[model samples]
Target: MINIVYVESSLELVPSEIIRHPSVRRNAKRKGKPPEENLLDRSLHHWAMDRLDNSEKRGRPDIIHFLLLEALGSPLNKTGELRIWIHTVQDLCIYVNPEARLPRDYNRFKSLIEQLYVDGRSPPNGDTILLELRKININQLRDSLNPDFVIGLTSRGEPSSFETLSKSLCDFNNPMVCIGAFPHGPYQKETASIMNKQINVYPEPLEAWIVNSRLIYELEKCLNVYNSQKIL
Candidate 1:
């Protein structure tokens, strides 16, 4: 199994900084609506009025939402061999089930994120993609997975050609890969200490979606995810 971790991700409650931004104010100013009401009128409005102070705003977790859409959707999840553990900057590690399908709908994903913010976990409705929630750090998470090999993807690491990625991971039965889900930030120190190797799949820095897609694609090929004739 090739498990992935998105560490120090920007999946936090909308900081007060952004909630009061001028752009958000302008949007809320329309019809003299409150910020939350304006942003969430058509949205799921999972955040209760009483709890808006503690509610999470969904900007950065959007990356993970897209990642889940790519990694855990449809026939890929049917393979039942992939796991994506998102370790947020707030120190909540969410394990997503490959067997459970995440909604492709943006509003649905936003609802899920809002719930994660309010409840510190997703409601277990069986179909929900969230598998587990743990109060742990990046180092502890890696140790918990205990994969035979650990690889960290970074823009500044040793260049790993795309052609060789599948072959590189194929040698290990259990390999855990990690990507920084934030736009641009320094990785936590523990992330470096926990990784067995660090590499950049692209010569230039790529967005999280591209990096994650390429890695998961190569991983699926290595696992023969869709090969009806081959057994995992």
Candidate 2:
């Protein structure tokens, strides 16, 4: 199986320091939840986020939302060849079950994640786990997965095509691809240290979901997931 890790993703609850801001308060009131229960979203909390550290690269759960929708709906995931994990900026790791059908609506996605934060897992009492949160950092996750290879995707890495990268990945029993899910900025120092090698799939920077789609398509081709269909 191939592992896809979204590192340092900007998904978290409103920080205590900014929870009382008018923007956060207003959004929380509209959502019928405490300010602290709502996800820290740049669209609804931009004014409040200005005072937080790394404002440019934070409060972007939408990035992960788009990425999850693309990935979970893809053939790679359907074949059970893909495993996904979200490593948030707050150092929380979310394990996504392949069977998990995430909400298509962004607001519902946000609410689900917020509840996961509160209950530590969705359904909170079910035998089957759809999504689960753990207080683990990127380094710990990397070590735990222990994939044969760890590839980090960054604009600063050696340039290559998805076809070539997918071929290289096939040589290993298990390989993990780490993609930055933040809107801006580089990988955190701890996340960077875990990469066996870094790769640049495109000459220019692309959004996280775009990289995810192209990469998964190429991987599916490599794994013969679409063997009966014309890929042209």
> Which candidate tops lDDT?
2
CA lDDT of every candidate = 0.67, 0.91
Candidate 1 lDDT score at position 49: 23
Q: What is candidate 2's local distance difference test score? A: 0.91
Cα deviation at 85, candidate 1, in Å, is: 0.8
Q: Tell me the spans in candidate 2 whose CA falls farther than 4 Å from its real position.
A: 228-232
Give the alpha carbon lDDT tens digit for every residue of 113-196 in model 2.
999999999969969999999988888898899999999999999989999999999788989999899997788888889999
**lDDT minimum window of 10 residues, candidate 2:** 223-232
lDDT of 1 by residue, 81-147 (tens): 6667888766678877655566788657756666655555567445454556678888788778889
TM-score, model 1 to reference: 0.76
Question: Residue 52 in candidate 1 has what lDDT?
Answer: 46
Residue pairs in clash, model 2 = none
- Superposed on all Cα atoms, the candidates' RMSDs to the truth, in angstroms, are 6.2, 2.5
Predicted structure with the largest TM-score when compared to the true one: 2
